[model samples]
Target: MKSYSAVVALAGLVSSVAAHGFISSPTPRQPGQGLKAACGDQVYNQQSSDHFGNVQGALQNLQGSQPDCRMWHCKGVPFSDAGEVFDYTPGQVIPMKVEIRAPHDGVANVSIVKVSSDTVIGQPLISWDQYALTSSPLSQHPDWTSFDIKMPDVSSECAKAGDCVIQWYWDAPKISQTYESCIDFKMGGGSGGSAPSPSASAAPASSAAPKPSSAAPATSATPTATVPAATPTPSKVEEVATPTASSGAGEGSTLPKSFTIDSFITWLRANAGSDTATKVSRAVAERAHPRAFRV
Candidate 1:
């Protein structure tokens, strides 16, 4: 009965916010059972019929909206008081879909944050951009469009730890505005799975900040390097839009069946010789962050 009400409630808000979009998959919300659980029962009451469309700020419509020191914005007070959680599996390519009401041909970005408790929002665990909606203004009105988002897999470590939030932000086409939404989920995978750099927490094949340049670490005093050393080699493999042709890797292969540039680099690290590997390794680190790489 209550579950039905939650669905109906969200549905009611779905009508007027036809200009932007909302998460339609993996169930988004505050904590308890569903959206109502995480966001609070009263959240539905505050909608102004046109709550989502044309809002200047992401959480501008929510009551008590305030600056979240750690995040782009917050509802000042917990809409649903935080702690309720959701569970997801690590290494699973979860499906995240969105319903874009008004097409602006914008772009979509997804990020994840690991929280220690339900009440606190943690620092960034994964920040990915353009994981979905390569371009925005999806279709046009009357022809509302659907964006199928490829959610990157979670690290086994974070999942077992419990409590996390997956945030989706869509850039308003031609405008400097963004629409934000989120869903809380816990990773339900085993602990032995591979993990990567916190920065590498996002999908490299389809998402993440713009590629970085190698200017941060190129020192004239130490021009060359070897062995392709990584301050830390993030083990989480990113799934690409196109799967890579499976290499004849043996049982211990640490790669996915995606022919990504990173995967090739991994192969190069092993077989491409030390000098080449060092050059590429530093370049890779520089790309992620100029200061992100080290010997």
Candidate 2:
């Protein structure tokens, strides 16, 4: 009887880990041949592995162990150079999947960054709130949901740079937690046929980082080789309540990364030039997330 009870307990534990929320579409966490695999470097899914971290806070990123959106450090997964690289076109429409094995209230953001070095992280090329602007993955999708994402164009230089990161951040506002993932890849295909949508583009590929100011131009010019100015701060959106995010947010964390329905709508409208952001104005943000409002 004792042996049977122990076996049953262990089985239950394994089931819970496998049943946690995970990104199933791109398969970055479990990428096979040809695509770089970095998920195994840290606590791929912490709350489960031995069930060590906070379970209810399965999405948390700023606390013990999983600091800065991830535990892999700023230079990215160590020895990543030995890993594989996924090949993609400059402007391809990519799809994403987030299996909410454990559904919770949150928002998702995806962005592109040029990995200038293994030691230094790069800036954003595109940033937007996937959940708030188009549809609420929280309320819209079933347990395991899949959605199509429009890819953005890269500068000829950026496309040829050979390495970049497609970063994803998930914020659980109701729970004050966040989850993160990245797909490393090499760009393929020709350039310049279609520019990135205004709603999708964020930081300039080659320019210095945008200064964190209330008055930065909505449409800034392309930059040269000089180091960028100060990091751009959250626009007026910082006034809203927000949870502390992973230090890993860097320059690519979008305005909706820290949302309170209001900030989300403001960001969505500015970039998308539509009323889509406002559509989800009732969104409740953190004490529950890997959250932010660019603040």
Candidate 3:
């Protein structure tokens, strides 16, 4: 009787952990051979088995583990494993979809993230302050499950295929679980192509367009490469400052002027009080020391 009860409880726990979310359309990055090499077989297998698992879970598995995994960035999936790179233009509107097997009320956003620095380029393309709320059924809130994000003009930095990614970030802060999905893309000349409409169950994709918000442009005459300017907490749909020398890091403590992953990690460590920064910093510091980084 005791053994049977234990087995049932374990099954329930596994089922609960497995019920999560991930990007379904625009085909987010997947765990593959490169991931197995960089992250090691264990971490890669975990994600390969369950792509919807949160960052914290993956980090937990990374105790004194692979430094090259970069688990906090796109769940550490490498671009070499990325099968297709979508060609996009500045104004292109791309259809997107997310599959939430279980809802956990929190916030979500989509942004252009520079792979090199793990920094968001400009503001988020779309955001939801109240996302994946369990009070309402997924059927009633189609916007949370399906939407569209406009590609902002990132031609200067994202002209190359591997330089940037369209990243979908969802953080259920209450649960301390962060989920990310990245789409590999680059800017291409010519008119941006039209996207197919989302499924009938989806809310009108037009409704997902975020309100305009202020953010600093990447400056040319690179000032002291500090952290970045302030960005809103993950709970709100707000602007994300560009990570550049002119943008400044966080408050207090100055490292070298050149902005790199090390600098960003330094910033993350410095800004450890912040909700987003702190969580990510802890995972990064614990799992691996700074290694050659890519998104």
Candidate closest to the true structure, highest lDDT? 3
Q: Which ten contiguous residues of candidate 2 have the minimum total lDDT?
A: 282-291
CA lDDT, every model vs. true structure: 0.37, 0.37, 0.64
* Ranked candidates, highest lDDT first: 3, 1, 2
Candidate 3, position 187, lDDT: 85
Task: Kindly list the per-residue Cα lDDT of model 2 for residues 112-147, writing each as its tens digit.
Answer: 544453221223322323232123433433212444
Specify the poorest-scoring 10-residue window by lDDT in model 3.
286-295
TM-score winner: 3
lDDT of 1: 0.37
lDDT of 3 by residue, 159-215 (tens): 888899988877665555677889898886666554456666654435443322243
Stretches of candidate 1 off by over 4 Å are 1-18, 30-85, 115-162, 189-295
lDDT of 2 at 258: 44
In order, how many clashes per candidate? Answer: 16, 15, 4
**Model 2 regions lying over 4 Å from their true place:** 1-20, 30-84, 116-144, 155-162, 189-291
Q: Could you give me the TM-score of model 1 versus the true structure?
A: 0.38
**What TM-score do all the candidates reach, one by one?**
0.38, 0.41, 0.65
The 10-residue segment of model 1 with minimum total lDDT is 286-295
